[model samples]
Target: MTETLLPTATGGEARSAAWTALRRVRGHVALTLLVLTVGTVIGLVGPWLLGRIVDLVIDGRTDELLPVVLGLIGVAIGQAIGQTVGTAMVAHVGQTVIAGVREKAIRQVLRVSEGRIERAGSGDVMSRVSGDVETVNEAVSGVLPTLLDAALTIVLTAVTLAILDWRFALAGLAAVPFQVVATRWYLRNAVPVIRAERVAEGSRAQQLLDSINGANTVRALRLESDHLAKVTAASDKARQLSIRMAAVQRRFFGKLNYGEFVGLALILVVGFYLVRGDLVTIGAASAAALYFHRLFDQFNVVLGTFDTAQSATAAFARLIGVAEMATPDLRDGGETDSRSGRGTDGSVSLRDVRFSYGADQHTVIDGVDLDVQDGEHVAVVGTSGAGKTTLVKLVAGLLPPEQGQIVLGGHDLAAGASGSGHRCVLVSQEVHVFADTVLGNLRLSGEHTSETQARSALDAVGASGWLSTLPDGLDTVLGRGGHSLTPTQSQQLALARLVLADPPIAILDEATADAGSAGAKTLEAAAEKAIAGRTAFIVAHRLTQAARADRVILLEDGRIVESGTHDELVDANGSRYAQLWAAWSTHR
Candidate 1:
């Protein structure tokens, strides 16, 4: 399967993304532009006042010196105030934009099909969320505003120089051609290089995360050397890309320095001629030279910030791309029943089901049909690669089959009837416990659940025994840093939350597989209580769970080979369930 967290925007798409982001904060943008304009205008007053003061001093007008100096100070103060306010406003707008992008991106990720995320891998998606989002933030907050200030400064200074003397303005702009060539060359070459750098960095991060997550497995298999080698290679590649980027910057800066030299040389050389010809006063020439010098400083700022600007552009595009992945409203063409509470019956049915991870790969789930009655416990057993988990995911509405229809409580599962509607809840083996109070963790199951309700649910899942041992009972915090829970306790807590959620159908995919023998027993009892009066499907790794189910299904290569009650399957001489029972009994 092709693994991609989100689509990468092309040139046109990147522009559209940037425009969209700007439009979101148009009011702040307009205000910032006004403030910056005021600041830029105020900044011009100082240079002009300096020139006037120089002329006055040369003409021996001592009386005007104090007034000009006072005016210069006032202009400087005004410029400082305007710049501070402008920068703050820009930062506020940029942060607002970043927050909106993050919220939208999170929503999109939450709504995307689970199958897509599973195929894409967590590292890739996380990189986009954390790394790309941060990159965009830096671009908006720092690089963009700096570039804008530099641009405005350059424009106003050039215009002032022109008004003073057209010849001086022309001389000041002598470096334009060289600067343009160098900038264009740098941008064109740097884009692909930086893009490669980002890709390499993401790969390196993924490699490190993989090693960390699988550290125990690596140690057990004595594959530390192999994993370390992989990490080293990825890190080396990232280092090389970083060095290449630095080299690109070095070359670009070298060219920019040469341009600055040429421009400054031309300005001084031209200003000397104009002064010698008596076409311009010494003060005017001095002002023109200062303008030229200031202009080059602004140009340098622009050039220096260009790399970050480009990187931000790329990051913005990626962020926007992920945000755009939100699925279309599933209720668009569907009818909404006036139903309020979840229906009592939780019967589920799958018809002509078929699914595959990718178009090019073989179908993992072939055309199959099944019926699960209300409040019936069905345990599905299969060997590795038998599509057991995929089947349950389809029924639980976590995935959509390529070609099939799943109905729950007479409502189409795929037609926006399921999510958070108490229709179905799937508890997989890997359950996450938030860093929150025990009460808070339980409340996450039902947003409106009261403390009393939470306590009762915990009791129902047999977690009350442990709950009382905690320092603060239900109020006691549970995840990292608070109260740590064992694997069994964690699974029990998950079951408690399930009881609170009280979905009509509960799908448990080896939910107790991680618990020890004693913990597994406790979890089994808790699971039984949690699923009382609810249609339950257990993807059983241990045959004991299947033996207690109302019906046991045996699957082979995505096809249902045999299905019957525990007693009936055992009696069937050569059936798949009978063979499985025999093997399970021997293992036990």
Candidate 2:
């Protein structure tokens, strides 16, 4: 599986993703533009009315002035109303956009290959889901409005200013050059910096989680200070990058303030001079000055919008990265038929199978041929780092072998031929108990499983001991502050789910290894009983489990070095299986 190639500059890809996200929220775009247009009309009408008031005052007419003033106030109120409605509409759009982004990110993570997830660092995935998605919220809430408001403000201000006086309008246009140049410089540099900073922050979060998860190891090894130093260093790098970006913003703001002051001063001096020289009327001068001030205000809003847009773009890129990393190879309609034993005839075969983690990596499984007949029991034995787990994964169809074919029921595993529930399933050493009831957790794998069926499965796995003790029995919650089951109980719960699923083929890798000998015996007997009429592969650590296998295979360094019935292999005095049996016996 190819993992996410982060830390590689993917600017072009990010831009494309951002545009796609924008397209997804087209409804919001339309509403924002409509509201902005109305708001701008109201805003422009108010200034024009003030200009008319000046015209009236110069004519020495005081009658009906109160009516005109009230008309202006009415226009102001209309502008306020338009802005309020527009803001509310935009806020709704922002929320919808964020929800879409979050869902897409989740789908991406789920679609990615299991091997990629393992190599990509669990911490990074967690960071992307929790932290990277939040960065995009700014784009939704702040960036969109900044964009619409800026565009409408600029358009209306420019038209009003030009109508008042083309010469002063030209001066108003001059500020654009400074604003454009400063903003361009800041954004061009800051986008990459901001993205890098976000990535670094994610790394830091991963490091912190690692420290917490490995707290026992650190304490035993006396490495507390060492781990802390690593976290501190990463955090410091993130802070420095943030400060540097802030400095860029400060410089940009400094230039904007200077440009605004210069534009305002020029308009005031030039307007008064021209009016006094009789080049224009005082009414015209007042109108032009008002237009000039409004232009500056609108221009500032526009620039602010562009800055937010840039930040949003950066956030969009990160979210896209998460999506791309987790893109699934196959799509399932998520339909299920739990009634009539969908994969009951499960039979799997691997021909010349060879597999690796990635390009040019050491092979995890090398050139092995195996067949699992329907309703047969097999045990796989190996030392640490043997490809036993990898082999089982191949049978379960979780990872497609790089060099060979894994066929299930005469059809390639890639075809997903076993129908709704998988033909083969693997239960591993690490068991997860989600925040759900005992029955909820079991029924998650099978849609139509009744409460009685789930309870039966739990009882089959010998998990009824603690489960029956619960207040709600089958309805009892299992995670967090709920039941707080031990590791052995958790493993049994996972097994219970499998029994509920009742896949034709099952692979159990150390399913009961951590549960002690009693748990192991219970699991072995349960497996023999539960898998009575189904194909099963067990990666056995205990010799007793291996001895009971109808057939046994010994793996070493990614290759099958020995295979036969357990008694037959044990009779071969110097064989790999013989040595394993001897070691297991000594330990017992």
Candidate 3:
């Protein structure tokens, strides 16, 4: 299998995403544009009033000066009010759209198959949720308002210059060629650098996740320095890329600065010529020059944010891609089957199942045939590298077999896990206690689960003994900052979730391994209750789990070496299971 990163939206798809978002907020967008346009119009009056005041002063019409000063004051106040309201509205709309996008992306990601997540590092997906969303949010909230204002102001200023004299507008056009060239050069150079920086940042994030997530292992193995060195190197590489991007950005700005200088100088030259040629009054020429200068400032705002806009665009594309990722609507379903000598649902059968991590890697699961009767508690026993967990995942539909058929509940595994009932579920020793109330976490099994149902699940999982000890009972918050659960307690909680989900088929891959020796039996009993009446596939890390199963299978090198009752396997002299049990018994 070839591993690849999650996709980014193509240009067309990004545009469609943007259009769809904008259309959803079309009402707010219209109001924002209207208010901003009003502000721009009011602002344009200021320079024209300054020109009128100059002309009046030159003509000795001193009385007209008061009105012009008052007009300037009014213009300032009106523009300020309009701009403030318009910008806030636009920002709110932007935030609303971004929040929806983030939520959708997160929801889709949570639905994505575990195998795909394993192929694409979790760090890459997490960074998009946090870092990329932040980037887009910053652009939308911070940069967008200013860019809109500048652009609107520039357009109105150009029109005002034209009203004063067509020549003034023509003169202002002098900067266009310079700005155009600068923009072209920047896009040609800076865009590639920005894209490279995003990739390098993603790599750095992945390395950071690796270092942090494996901190305990790194310390235990005494390779902390090695991991730290790799993290530092990745961070430094990203930093270097950022610096290179900044250099390109600065050079782009320098070229814009040249355009600004050239633009202002030409406007002045044109104003001076018009004044000398008697084509316009001194005040008109002065006002035209002032308008061009104001235009340049707004032009700078619009053009200078080019890189930030590009960054946001890139981030938005990634977010939209994630949000739009296809997900199967899976529901557990089963049909009647008597292949296992029992006319019951939830019987699982695997035929020549094979799997490998990568093309270059050895086959992790060789041809393995197995049949699990409905409600049968089957345990798979294996040494450390025996691919037992992989088999369990395959049975639970978490992974696809490379070249075999897996039928769950008489339904082909390739057929979507859709039925009228709860679907197959996989639970591992690594349990998750989300930061939520006890009832809230339980309801994760199904959002519609009632408080009564949650209580019942806890009771079913043998967690009722501890439930009464919580400060707020079912309302008590659990996980990170709230109530801390012991390993056994956590496993019990996980079992409660399993009961709430009530899948027809359950795969428990070392579900009790983390409880340690002291609580092993307690967790094992809870697991029994959780999977009662369901076809269960247990990846038995400890022999104790195997001892309780209806039947036990020994796996070696991805093949089933022996399949029989645990007692039968133990009775067979010199067999692998017998040898393992003999050693286990000696230790006991």
Task: Single out the weakest 10-residue window by summed lDDT for candidate 3.
Answer: 335-344
Candidate 2 per-residue lDDT, tens place, 1-588, comes to 113433222679876765676688887778777987898788777767776788788888778578879989988898888877887777677667667766877776765557766666677777766765665676656666656666787787778777766767777666667777777887787777876777777778778888999999999999999999999998998899889878877777777876787777777777788777877677677777787777777676666555556656666666677766533243222232465345556677888999898787898899989887878888998989889988898777666678888876565765552342256667898888989888888877777778888878888878778877889988888898788888778887888877776677788887878877777777777666666667889998677877887899889988988989988999997887888788879988
Model 2: clashing residue pairs? 108-326
lDDT of 1: 0.83
lDDT of 2: 0.75
Per-candidate clashes, comma-separated:
0, 1, 1
All candidates in order of lDDT, best leading: 3, 1, 2
Per TM-score, the best of the predicted structures is 3
Q: What is candidate 1's lDDT per residue for 1-588, written digit by digit as tens?
A: 124546666768777765788897888799899999899889888877887877888889879799889999999899899988888888788888788888888777876778887776666678788998889888877877778788899988988999988988888777999899999999888999888877777778778888999999999999999999999999999899888888999999999988889888988888789889998877888888788888999998999888888777777777777887646343322223233245576889989999988789888888879999989999999888998998998887778789989888777766663432357888899988999998889887767888889888889989989988999888888788888999988998899888877778899999999988888898888988989888999999778889999999887777787888999989998887888789888986
Off by over 4 Å in 1: 1-5, 219-222, 269-280, 326-347, 352-364, 383-385, 397-423, 446-453, 500-502, 516-518, 541-548, 578-588
Candidate 3, 1-588: lDDT as tens digits: 113778788879988998998899999999999998998898888888888989999999998789789989999999999989888988899999999999999987877767777777787798789999999999988899999999999888888888888878887898999899998998998888887777777778888888899889999999988998998998898899889888988888888888778778888888899899989889888888788889998888887898899999888888998988876556544444432122247778899999988678898899999998878989998898898988887777667777999877677867663442244778898989999999898888878888888888899888999999999999999988999989898888888888877777788889888777778888888888888888888988678888989999999999999999989998887789989988887996
TM for every model, in the order presented, reads 0.86, 0.83, 0.91
Candidate 2, residue 231: Cα displacement in angstroms equals 2.6
The per-model lDDT (C-alpha) reads 0.83, 0.75, 0.84
Number of the candidate with higher lDDT, 1 or 2: 1
Instruction: Point to the candidate with the largest lDDT.
Output: 3
